[model samples]
Target: MTDDVLLVHGGTPISGEIRVRGAKNLVPKAMVAALLGSAPSRLRNVPDIRDVRVVRGLLQLHGVTVHSGEEPGELVMDPSRVERANVTDIDAHAGSSRIPILLCGPLLHRLGHAFIPGLGGCDIGGRPVDFHFDVLRKFGATIDKREDGQYLTAPQRLRGCKIQLPYPSVGSTEQVLLTAVLAEGVTELSNAAVEPEIEDLICVLQKMGAIISVDTDRTIRVTGVDRLNGYTHRALPDRLEAASWASAALATGGSVYVRGASQREMMTFLNTFRKVGGEFEVDEDGIRFWHPGGPLKAIALETDVHPGFQTDWQQPLVVALTQASGLSIVHETVYESRLGFTSALNQMGGHIQLYRECLGGTPCRFGQRNFLHSAVVSGPTKLEAADLVIPDLRGGFSYLIAALAAQGTSRVHGIDLINRGYENFEEKLVSLGARVERPSAS
Candidate 1:
């Protein structure tokens, strides 16, 4: 795969308006959930991304008819004519993304069987699928491990049951929705993840005629229905991507208008932005982000669920914190190994120290041992571009922003990883007037 990308000289501040599209987090899940409809489903404002393409290909493999206009990223899926699905090919991408595993319920409900390839996400910690399996099993699905892949079969009709997740994992919570929506009765899932994407999925499903209720206390109640018809709804704009660019505005001492960005979904991030001396204004079209053209003050930041600072937004924001003038303490409660990227930043002359104790919020998964799950960043140091590799989604974004803000040119490898989430990121870079090139691998 061609994974090499280069970022040339910075010093030039990005001064333009960028229009944000649909949320990458919501589009793919909505696509997979479309399968549960068993009819034609139309998704509006879908962003063009690799993961979305992968999900599309998998759905087409199962005999679903998918169509869209040449230019509009909108999608339409007609699942009535689902053809032959090559599960082997789908499995090849299992290690590529985490969303593939959530397909088990819809595939089983439609085809009576499911063959999952594998799953991958941020390498922050052991993101297990045990919770997903337990929920599916509770719904009367039989799961089996095979030499080639994992198979899930529903020998009898799935009956609703109470499912309690050990952690409010986004993936597990989605699996519950996918499995329980069609199970024989009402399913109550407590300790559910309240991420915006989850809510968006519920919203789309509701439009498709599914019975669901959301409580303020993070409990989701889904009443199983015998059938779900196709739906046409617009996907939400991506909050994580919006937050990344907001960080870029902070790190580079620049102002940018992130068109279509909604402040309502990012209240926690907006509050933290103000605390860091970043100024923002929300208009009808989008949000504008800028630093006050002075030293950014460091503040305590913690990663949490929706209505809190998002864990996925942590990496890109960390780069901004490195530009802050004082010690910016960050407690990453979602993933322990997430702080590993700090060492790479340190190599580039950033002052960051990691720790085990939660420096800012409620204790989380990594509260002890050598798991440096928190970071103390001291900065305003000049950054010089160096050879770097893209580690994960948000980290890749931070590295690019750093390159764009640094002096020398930067060569970043494994750039294809960013395509999994960010839609047309390279094009967006050029739109922002960045000097970036993706050289074909030798």
Candidate 2:
């Protein structure tokens, strides 16, 4: 809790019933696909965030084990002692994330040589683990790149490769399905990233036996199998924290049930939250969202990859498009610095602007690539509260949905970077009523 400081207050409206777990992007890539199993897996609705305690402390520093599963967001792991750690405990979790470069292909297929280190995440993008070490040197490994991080080395026993990305990257297509599910023969790929958390990490690597397929255009093949085992599975329910509490229940008009929200992984963020007027219902378990009292409509949108429209649900639906009404726009074809957190929603008054080009959508690849990556946003604009700071993890939950739809007291400072993917977010923002505190140390 390094000098944590929230102290919210503001307008308030966050209605109740919250319960989304699992999927801070598919439970840390299904705990790095349980290190390409051989025995112990399990997992469940896991999500205590901070990137699942930084991939469960880099899977207990590569020996795996990681117990606890009688229920209550289970997680068993084990990985039959897949050892090889300590480069000062993998550089003491380097900058503490970028999931140790997706555990460098299940630690070079369970330890032939690994040690990644130095990687950290969430500046939103330029996400270059050099295409996860160029897809593990096209599945043959042997990397080296020193200075403190990349060393990898399979030497000989990782084959598969056909590649083709250029950009569909859901973390370089889960680092080419955790290194082509144990590389050896057929891998394919081509513009990958079919995100439903990479098709639930290809159903946790086809229940850990692997084979994989998926096509409808953005290819993917896999194949390579010699052995793989453990898997109980369950995860798959955080549609980016249920579209960030359905864009904080349409930026505070409020309703928000969310309860393990899924409506088919939130049908393109509930059809762009009902084209911005926002009013949801769904229910085979959850998805309520609200705000239907009037004027929100603006839209235009873009952010593709996965069934499209999700650059992490365009920063909590761009703080509910600043109270929507007229011109919304967006574009952001996925992280070219994710619209620089709309410059703190244009300093909380929220008019937005930011452009570089690619405006009303399409034209992407960050348009001319100068990269403001488009925005616009006008709107009903009235927000007020200021002092924010927390900048990344979906721009710190879109600055806690613009300080709970601002009007006065904010102070938001780094909110522990929204607990690195929201779980227990100050007890789910005090069970959604959200007055929020933590101040003290005068």
Candidate 3:
């Protein structure tokens, strides 16, 4: 047994309280936004996750002085020395994260050139960087693809332009926002992703003296400024992490209070959870979720952009749906290969079937594309423990939920992958009374 393996004794309900700090998606981007400023910026409610560490390292490498603030989960960053820094060993970050690519605009603004190493993220689909490069090109940055990485140069001051995204992608939208804030002139972005995290990022940029506005019709306009100061802002709680815990409580027939969870961002997920026979109560501090002692109802769910079912919430909820009374249909419109993790669930006695055609929702990009992006889960089946391998961040959490809801002992490998998003999850599991142990140490 290796250090990454966990032994889980199943049939235990996960009960207790766990606090979620800043969002994994938003915090890193906020850190990256600090590079656009001249003075030190303070970010509160930051989570201690692997992605945060990765971004912090990248920032430090770029000559940004990052240090702990007075409070826990607070970071103060100074980007004054960024222009004088000589970046080396950048390829060491290659295949580690996709974040390095987002550094192009800020680097190019400070220093006329930037080098982006090979990017790597979850193997869910062909998450190409075309949208990013295209947006940068529209902002007057030239990109040269090399064998090891991509080199970008801005011959002059970047000027903003009009951009209409082919899809309302979160990453592409973020790239445009980060790049457009410092560019010259006005930038109009149509069909932008308006996720709460993105809105928070916009707020961060606004505090730093950037001119940006969001219209009702999924459009955003950013007017570039000559200089920007620092900002003091608190990040929003992790709604995706909160939903995962809610699904865990439902799957294990337990109750959990997720402290720091906000209700505004989770209204859609809460409605769907209620429809599935789950119960939840909202308070000022956080939200409490439970199974509510009944047969879980089956429902059709479709993953989409903001104001729709989130793609990140689908995997963990699918584990809970296996206890539903009938068939549950899931249409994945976000990532083409997201449903591939269902094969591991079926290995553990789940009756989930995958299909190439979209079943419960309108045809999406993956429909008729030969990708198994749809799933039919026939549930009320007893789940037995089996050896499992963690696939991705969300899928790894789902496997942990499944193991806790199963009937026997199970071995879970690659649990460290969960640290990329979840903060101190093993400690949280223990606090929730889960019977998990390091196999080698145990």
Best by lDDT: 3
Error of 1 at 345 (Å): 1.4
lDDT of 2 by residue, 1-442 (tens): 4377787887978888888887887788888888888889898888887878878888888788897899898989888887887799778778857877888887887777887768777787687777778778878887888888778899788999899998887888888888888888999998787878889889888988899999899898989998889899898888888888888878889898888787887787788889788889886888788998878899888888778777888888888888988988888887888888888878889998887888764547767768788888988899999888876878887897888889888887878877878788788778887888887774
Each prediction's Cα RMSD? 1.7, 18.4, 1.2
Better of 1 and 3 by TM-score: 3
> What overall lDDT, based on C-alpha atoms, would model 3 receive against the true structure?
0.92
Question: What's the lDDT for all of these models?
Answer: 0.83, 0.83, 0.92
Tens-digit per-residue lDDT, 1-442, candidate 1:
4445665566566656787788988899999998999679999888888888888888887888889944487798998876547867777677767777878899888888888766777777778877777888889999898877678899888899998877788888888898888888899999899888888999889888899998988899999999999988888888889988888888878788998888888888889889989999999989999878878888888887676788888898888888888788899888778888777677777889988777875758778666788889998777777888888888888888888777777788778888888888888878877788866567
Give the clash count for each candidate.
7, 0, 0
In candidate 1, what residue range of length 10 has the lowest lDDT sum? 1-10
The per-residue C-alpha lDDT of model 1 at residue 390 equals 80
lDDT of 3 at 45: 98
Candidate 3 stretches with Cα past 4 Å from truth are: 84-88
The Cα error of candidate 3 at residue 219, in Å, is: 0.7
TM-score per candidate, chains pooled: 0.96, 0.35, 0.98
